[model samples]
Target: MELQNRREFGKKMLGTTLNYFLLESLFTSQAFASSVRPVATHWAKQLTEICNDLKLQKIPPVLWQQQVEKLFNQIELPELLKFIDFETLTRGFDYPDLGVNTRMVKFPKLDGLPEKTVFIRKIFGMKKGRAIIPHGHSNMSSAHLVLKGEFALKHYDKVAEEDKYLLIKPTIEKTAGVGSSSSVSDEKNNIHWFIANTETAFTFDVIMVDLGGKAYDIHNIDIAAGEKAGNGLIRAAKLDVETALKKYGKQHH
Candidate 1:
């Protein structure tokens, strides 16, 4: 009986010690990670943290929008752009001028930053009277922050999906200037249209399409051609890239 008691005590001590070590290790790792990627007005890092949390499914997509809006509201556009090396990049960068859509540019992540691969970061530039077009996606979420000029931004909540159309209802319509922003998720504010209202407009974006490990789909909605649905909704047809740009990009109003 004495030997049995001793064995039980030893087992209990071992379990306690293991738990203590495990907790210590966890705290240590968290601290190390925090040091490696401090998030003090480092706009990119904060965005990455959210992207990581998002891809891990720790936070729902709808909540991702709130966090992104908060971040954009907190940071200045020039500061954010400098961190991402935007001026250096566009100094000599060139692209074919588009009459209807944005020019998407992918810049390298700042060196020494911790890796966060769940999302793709990009800058979309547009001429006045051009747009980002109206589009909805599956298994994706994105945030767009106006960095250069103004845009007439519109958002829609996808009500239903059919073989050829996405039934959606308008959710937000407003003029967005520098530091203004919008975000999209699969279930909320799913379709977004951005028409540049300035001579030149730029938006820095973080897009994650590989949610749930399933293939993502981009459905460009032809808003004007959408069939009227009851209850202030519209069944918009999906369009090809060329068609979408030509059709919706030049529509300023």
Candidate 2:
């Protein structure tokens, strides 16, 4: 009888081990047998999971976009503000002309957010008439959620690339308000520009770049100087960062 009992106990342990491995593989792209989890967080753990999947390319881009948009729409804005101490960060902040002030978002130790995250998270602040400039990204994915005020948000689909310009057409242009959100990837809506429409506007950003360890680039454009191409397209001349900021940053009219 003791021998039989030992056999039963061994079977039970094997079953439990299989169950654990199954769950681990399901949660991550890599099988548990070989994979190590990148980072852990107590605050915004769900966000971290999504970003991990994004970096791993475990989900489709459309699905990722939907997930990010739904996440912010469902976020408890008030709770988030309190958690991040938004008021303390933005209070008495000096405004910049035509550009945004970028602040890194750090989850407090008390909140159990690790010093390192799966990806970059940021808060961008802009004064009225200021803009984040027109830019396109490659080999990256990002999401922006409006936390306060409003922005004249615009998006353009990449048509073609020139030696010195990006040919794009407007795909989205709207006054995005609090809780409004959008996602960008090279696959869709690769280009974006944000102009603050209210006294002050703030957006919380989720950024994941170089998912496949490929070279990534940001193309800043001088939209004002671009000649209109046919079919509502514009051939926006690319500009260096300093030149783009100087030309496009002041009080976006």
Candidate 3:
């Protein structure tokens, strides 16, 4: 009877110890997740402030680019994703079999904010071999941050104008992935394209525009059909939104 009691006590103690460890682990993980919330909150506040200031100050495009890059460089990929509530922001669209699809992160509607204030954020989800069709912004500025996977980005300087086409001079071409960021403005490397180099990829963009100014237009270009215009410049053919979307919509399944 004494041996039976001892065995029962031993089993009870082992079970208690196991339960205690499991609870401890669960609490630790929750605590860790909570600890990162503040960091994410800080980033959200900072971005809001920057966008607000841009609206009031209308800072030069170069300065705007520099400020945005500085802020983005401070955070690494893991930290960026940790605080971001992807489930809340994401609309959960069906991923296209090929090419890229954009999902806009819905910003909470704020009281007293103007109806036309241009503050936009979006995620570009891309499948491998698909590309973000070449396009340029009009009277706007944007920052692109690679949140996941890999992409090959090419930028071109809209140097001069030919009769109906923009004479674009190749600026820089490079591969970018998590932690990589780039910016575009009305001036500078405004014309750009990104090709997904991984099985799946995502890019986060914060875009600000002057709604009262001109309706921002994405001037699309066809690189394959571009003609050399000397001095390393190429005259790219302009493509309407519908044509551009149809042609570069899909590359592979």
Candidate 4:
């Protein structure tokens, strides 16, 4: 009876050990599967289709932005990074004096498309407290994706105009981090400001320029703290580049 009991205990120990190994193997397989990189050509093909649709459909600004956002959502960050030349993109960041810098990813121009088909892709590298000052786009649609670190995004709608001041109502405000994305169009959330909330941050942007017009213009606006309307929209004054930078420049270390 003693021998029989010892054998039963041994069997139980073996069963527990086997179960642990089986579970670990299953988890290892899953981790390896998720780490596999996607086919790079697939993204190129998808981008081509999006650009072609934009040219053919000439969709409304809001709808066009939605389509672009949907397509971008399908791509993973690792897969998208495959197309960018990080060595060139990070060159400026290597030097401290450059401060905040933006570099474009060189992509082959979409062939067999009309001259109006415009594609612009860029990466912005910034230090803490640096900002892309409040600005609005004209005749353009774009998307901003946070690749690393955190950012504060504030968006506003142009509601009323008073001389040089534009009455803008705050629309959306949120904190975004890795894998997060936001979009803009002439009709929705047209004006926005972005500030880095970490020691360093990187953001990628894809822009379709002059979708329905000749040129796309970015107009920067100054916040009017003293001017507020009953409707909740605040007044903003436009500022030149020099003045805007002085007002919104990054904090010094």
Candidate 5:
């Protein structure tokens, strides 16, 4: 009986292990994994210290909607095209019950922008919650737009590295209210990280611009407060506000 129990336990463990490996593989691509090195060196190495002191605040939804709508109206799509580079925007995941999707769009005639690469799409259910992991990117800048719902966004700056990715730092938490958006441009060096802080789920939209190439990269990072409970890869992205403004904000700016 003892021998039989041991065999069954071993079989179950193996099955579980195999299932996990398959799921991870299905979600992550080899190209995306290799892209991490550049993001780590560029954003993590350059801005990790300076941004540590920066804090974040919340923006209300009505104000957010008005601002984005105003910016879109003043900025013509073609004029907006000049600063346009790789665009990746996602919306969804506020309630957990709603489905989500991520899409990539590329433009060639934009001039000075990379060819055959860019991601543009509507996303849903790709983000949620208040607590997120601290992370940085290599060659991307991002703009987050909240089409609907209310949310709190906390910004964090990496202070020190416990080990390659295990970060220790002070955080700046802010709320993006509802219908509002926040953008971070990639400095020649610095990038910022953030998380959602709403009680229930909220819906929002985001646009990510890849400055370097068609590929986007993110490092799986863990933070001090969120680590104890094992919430890994909760918050992350590829780009900063400055880059967002310079490359894509001409219409709004």
Candidate 6:
């Protein structure tokens, strides 16, 4: 009987140790995931699909987000937690252009829209005529929400492609109607470029929706001399709201 009691105690101790180990492992995994960036490919593919659908079908962004939220909510918590929170990433970059004099705060998740991937980004002390370099998404598209000042966006298309040089030209396609949102097959207007203009250093929000799974998609092309007409341009487009404001300010002031 004494031996039986000892065996029972041993079993209980073993169980307790196992429970502790499991809890520790869970905590460690959560910590690891929180620190890691989301895999770019997974998020970029989905986001690209969304952009194409919106541009082609003329579907509203809000409605698209709703559908995405539903799909993402079904993802396991471990996978869902992999994203870098906007507030967190903002703190890492130092922006003097947007007059971001204060620390950034992650926009709180709206109660019903738990799956919407939204962020409120700020660039402090920004001004007009500043240069925004060319870049492209290996997988995403972004929208600038003018929270504070005005911004100008110039979309460029690759006019020519060459092994030695990259040639590009600017084009503006007014995205006013529904069909504008649905057409994604031809994204010639969605190429490489930059942004800049004149405005007071201020802050604005950029809603960077993922195209596949990456943070930013930058495609930098090299426009070399003697390149054939068919291949003379490199394209990298950027959207900075502050640049738009600068243009507006110049016109009014």
Q: Best by TM-score, which number?
A: 2
lDDT of 5 by residue, 1-253 (tens): 9999999999999999999999887555443434443433432222222222121113332233344344534433333322222123322223322212333433222223334222233333233442223355444444454443455554444333333443333344566554455543333112333344343323333343444334555543433324431322322222243432233222121
On TM-score, the stronger of 2 and 6 is: 2
Q: How accurate is candidate 1 locally (lDDT)?
A: 0.79
Q: Which is better, 3 or 5, measured by lDDT?
A: 3
Residue-pair clashes per prediction, in order, are 0, 1, 0, 0, 34, 64
Tens-digit lDDT track for model 2 on 113-174?
45687689789998888889999987888899999999998999888999999999889989
lDDT of 4 by residue, 1-253 (tens): 9999999999999999999999998886555434432333445555556766665555676776677677667787776664465555776474222235788776533333233335787888888888787877777778888887898889988775555677788898999888888888778888888888898888888787876645887777887342787687788887776676667656456
RMSD over all Cα atoms, model 6: 13.8
Q: Which residue ranges in model 5 land beyond 4 Å of their true spot? A: 1-119, 126-133, 157-163, 166-171, 188-209, 213-215, 225-253
Candidate 3: where is the Cα deviation over 4 Å?
Answer: 1-37, 87-93, 106-118, 161-163
Residue-by-residue lDDT tens digits, candidate 1, 1-253 = 9999999999999999999999998896566445433333366667778888998999999889899889888876555665565785456444334434334444333345455466787788767887888899899999988888899999999988999889999999999998888999997999999888888888888888879888898999889888888999999998998888777767544
TM-score of every candidate relative to the true structure: 0.77, 0.77, 0.75, 0.73, 0.37, 0.37
User: What shift in Å separates residue 136 of candidate 2 from its native position after superposition?
Assistant: 0.5
Q: Residue 221 error for model 4, in Å?
A: 0.9
RMSD of 3: 8.3
Model 6 Cα lDDT, one tens digit per residue, 1-253: 9999999999999999999999998886666544442433444345445555654545554455444444343333334323424334444455444223334433322222224344333333234533333333333334432222333444555454444333565465232211112111123444422233434323332334443343444444432122344343443223344543243222332
Q: Which ten-residue region of model 5 has the weakest summed lDDT?
A: 48-57
Clashes of 3: 0
lDDT of each: 0.79, 0.80, 0.76, 0.72, 0.38, 0.40
